[model samples]
Target chain A: MSRVVVDVVLKPEISDPQGQAVLGALGRLGHDSVRSVRQGKHFVLEVEGTPDEAELKQIAETLLANPVIEDVELHLPKD
Target chain B: MRIGVITFPGSLDDVDAARAVRLAGGEPVALWHADHDLKDVDAVVLPGGFSYGDYLRAGAIAARSPLMADVVAAAGDGMPVLGICNGFQVLCEAGLLPGALTRNSHLHFRNRDQVLVVERADTAWTQDYRPGQRIVIPVKNGEGRYVAADADLDRLEGEGRVVFRYAGGNPNGSSRDIAGVTSENGRVVGLMPHPEHAIEDLTGPSTDGLGFFTSVLKAVVAA
Candidate 1:
């Protein structure tokens, strides 16, 4: 079985309070090396066969991510 | 007047929505997420709760549910529809409304009494209140911050479609302090606050929320 993964994150223009809170917590924990953090969602889909990039994009855009406030990226093996 | 209250799995406020409809002298019809039948109701209410267990994102799954297809079509026909809290998210995700509700800008779930100014009273849900009227209702939510493209927001503002604006401190950092909005035709209304929960003074911070239900009933009577 092949797995296709999609990562959804708030667009740069959108404010991410959850991510900002994590950054604050990291600072409190003294993780000075980390400059910033942006929170996002990750979805791993196990399909019967490796789907082409076009089909994957449709899935991510239609169901996995909201285009209004989020950006989506697909992780797939190069053909 | 019959108002259909859709109960998606994990919905916490459908009962309250029904109660509000009944209190407003309208029949409350129960609608299920999986059912295509709208039960011939004159209006529809997408009540609040973590539909689909809020999987993936709040209201995302429920927006794509089977019954939403019917709701969308009916809404297009100018049937009055109201969405509360998670219901608001569902309406946005379903393309029935513009903008999205994200995590509260403060990164916390806030629940409290909130004051709102009725900016537009022409909508199917707000006809009972006068413009600039101030009302108190209970607001409870986590991802209630509203965000939209600048141009879309400007249009919503320029057209005077904003139904409710925060009068007190902005509770969830919603852009432009918007607490609720109405469709271009004013047939659909969506808001982050729980009007259904504030119908009775005995249980809620105030009975101001009852105006929304009463307004819809009035709309039906006039129609």
Candidate 2:
């Protein structure tokens, strides 16, 4: 079995309203050092065999993330 | 021909959607999320609510539910499907519709009677009204903002796929003032308003929402 870690995040062009709200809350809480905050989803997957990088990318593109507004990153399991 | 309404665990409007179907002179069939069987229904309605408690994303969890596979296939065969509110979220997450519903721009759950202009009367759901007809219906949601890529938005607008546009004022800051949209083939539609809630004047602000139900009947007969 192989393990795969995928992270889906909104594209730079799309507005991150939730992250902006959190940034505002941080300033209100007196944490002024924080410059920016971008939020995204992290998912872990276990597959029976060692899937190729192309397969992983296809899965992430087709199902894990919406390419129109989001980008995806795949972390393959170490040997 | 019967309209099937699938009830997810946390669905809040399945009953009302079925009632609206009955009122529109169509038999209503109750379906379940876990069940893959579609029960030979002629059409399907994914009613609104916080399905799967809106975990992962508003409709992300429910979009992958067992029944949705069947729903997607049936929709591919030209079966009409309408999604309202959270149901609209599910359709987007499932890739049956474009765009995503994000948190309201003003950061509050809005609930009120909203006016919408029908942009296209060609969809199976909006054929009862003429193009540019105005109607009032209730829209309630916090994550109802619709967003898409600039190119996709241009395509949607250019191809006349937009079904409804918010009128008077943009309530939730949806891009291009889009309140609803139809699929490429016009067999599927998703909207952020509660048409079923506005079908009866005794309980709702207006009966303008009945056009959606009646429009489907007309389409079904014409088909």
Candidate 3:
């Protein structure tokens, strides 16, 4: 079995209210050194044997992320 | 006129949209998201709700549903399609409309009666109202903020595709205070407010929303 990780995040130009809220909470909790925070979703997929890189990219682009407002990154095992 | 109201698994306002169509003197055909059939309806309404439990993102999964393929094809041919609230999200996700509806800047699920100005009355959905007319309708959503590329936003404004603009106050921090927008062909419209919920004075804050249904009926008949 192989695992692929997908990270979906809002584009930098778009506003992130949830991430801002979390940053505010962190400030209240006295995490002063933090500069900024942007929230994102992480998905770990377990696939049979070897995962196809192209299929994983398609899944990430078509479903895991919205290209209009989000960017996605894929983490795959080294061949 | 027969208007189809599509119901996804978690749709909460399909019945209300149908009721609005009936009130507008049109027959309402119920459509399912899992089917490809459009039921020969003259118009289609993508009603609001957390379809697919809003997984991944609001309206993301539902946008790729089977029925949406037909909806997109029909919309391309100038069939009138109205999407309300989550329906608006679906329309954007399906690429039937430009821009994306994102989380509200306030970070809360807001529900309230909002005022909007009809900026363009030439679309299939807004013909009943005069330009610059003000209407009160219930706005409800958690992720309703509208965002788009700056050039695209400017182009929409330049092309007069912005159908409605929030008046008095912006409910969700939408860019340019846009409450609703229409496709370039003017037959498809998607908005973040629940016009279905405001079709009747007895249950809604005002009867202003009836114009949307009535306008579409007129458009279909005229076409």
Candidate 4:
């Protein structure tokens, strides 16, 4: 069995309002050292058999992320 | 003219959209998300709502529904399609339109009457209005901020594809105050306002939105 992890985040050019809100709260709570906070989605997938990078990339690009506003990164489990 | 109002599982404004069509003298055909049929409608309206509970993303899942396949094709063949609010997000996700609707910069679910200036009246959906007409419509959504690459925005502005712009003030911080835009051929339009809810004087901010429904009939006749 293999587990694939995907992280999806908004593009840098796109405004992250939620992240900004969190940053505001962090400052109020006295976490001044923290510079920024960008929110994103993380998904872990379990497959019966090991999947190739291309297949997982297609899944990440197609369903897990929107190319227009979001970027995606994949993390495959080590053997 | 027959106008199709699609109802995804979580759609909340299908009935209102259909009523707008009926009030505008067009037959409102109910279309389902899972069904592949378009019911031979002359035009289509993707109404406002939190389809799929906005799970993965607003309108993302619904954009990939079986019926959307047909919508993409018909829209390509010059069938007029209007996407409102969440519907606009779906159109962007489905690649029928450019850009994406993200959470409002204020991170609030904004609901209010908004004044918009009609920039283009020659499209399949805006023919009933004169250019630069100011109309009042209800704008409501959490994810209504429109974001696009700088180059795309410039091109759209150059081509006059921007159909509507906020007049008084920007509600959701959309790029250049753009409330709505059109496809290259001017057939498909997507906007982050509730035109369907603004069709009746008693129930809406104004009857200004009736033009969108009425315009499609003329568009069909002209076709």
- Across B122-158, the per-residue lDDT of candidate 3 in tens digits comes to 9999999999999999998999999998888999999
Q: Candidate 2 — which residues are off by over 4 angstroms? A: A1-3, A30-33, A44-59
**Model 4, which residues run further than 4 Å from truth?**
none
Q: What global local distance difference test value does model 4 have?
A: 0.94
Tens-place lDDT per residue, model 2, B1-223, is: 6889999989999999999998888899999999999998888899999998887678888888999999999999899999999999999998899998887888889999999999999889998889989999999999898999888999999988899999988888899999999999998999999999988879999988888888887777777
Q: What is the lDDT for B29 in model 1?
A: 96
- Local lDDT at B129 for model 1: 91
Model 2 steric clash pairs: none
- Chain B, TM-score, each prediction? 0.98, 0.98, 0.99, 0.99
Q: What is the lDDT of residue A1 in candidate 1?
A: 62
Query: Tens digits of per-residue lDDT for model 4 on A1-79?
Result: 7889999999999989999999999999999999999999999999778778898999899888998889999999888
DockQ of all candidate complexes: 0.89, 0.45, 0.88, 0.85
Candidate 3's TM-score reads 0.98
Clashes of 1: 0
User: Which runs of model 1 end up more than 4 angstroms from their true locations?
Assistant: none
Model 1 chain B lDDT-worst window of ten: B193-202
